[model samples]
Target: MRKGIIGDILHGEAAYIHDLRYQMKMKTGEGVWRPYHLAKRNGNLYPTHGLGPVAQYMNLARTDDQFNTIISYSTPAIGRNKYAKKISQRKTYGINRF
Candidate 1:
């Protein structure tokens, strides 16, 4: 079961935690567009942040445990779009395009 859990994580079986903590207020900063743009190109922006420790603990690629495959899913950016519309209406952040 433990091994399976680790495998699941390595195979992209977790939701991204960045949006949970990164509020719309934080997006108003000047340089905040970098991550948003990068995230646009990369489906999962922080896979290493979430998976690195697990892989290290499991000794993946160093021991018997290894990655067989990897998968990730990108949900619709509904929350972000809604928030962007609100911000755009206010013209507070200059995030018209989102």
Candidate 2:
């Protein structure tokens, strides 16, 4: 789980799938829909997780009165590319990555 691997993270993601399966009366080990982790190129992975709370607090005051702009930056994506390469290698070895 400590490694920056997609499969490792998805093993933990089973909790969310389990919850959904329970509501639908499906088995806990039911198969998942493919492409569940298909994130778009340069897109938000969980936009609502960040935006939902902010939208609910529209009246919140900012520390700087002249707050008219916001910006963000992301570091290089070595970790992500490495995970993709690992997944690719698994496919080449006929491994069940999920």
lDDT per model vs. reference: 0.55, 0.32
> What RMSD does each model have against the real structure?
5.3, 15.2
Predicted structure 2, TM vs. truth: 0.31
**Which lDDT tens digits does candidate 1 get at residues 1-98?**
25666354444233447543243345556336643563355366566667776677656778787878766557766666666666555332324446
Q: Which regions in candidate 2 have their CA more than 4 angstroms from the true location? A: 1-40, 59-76, 86-88, 92-98
Candidate 1 residue runs with Cα over 4 Å from true position: 1-16, 20-32, 35-39, 90-94
Which pairs clash in the backbone of model 2? none
Cα error of candidate 2 at position 36, Å:
6.4
What is the Å distance of residue 92 in model 2 from its true position?
8.6
Poorest 10 consecutive residues of model 2 by lDDT? 10-19
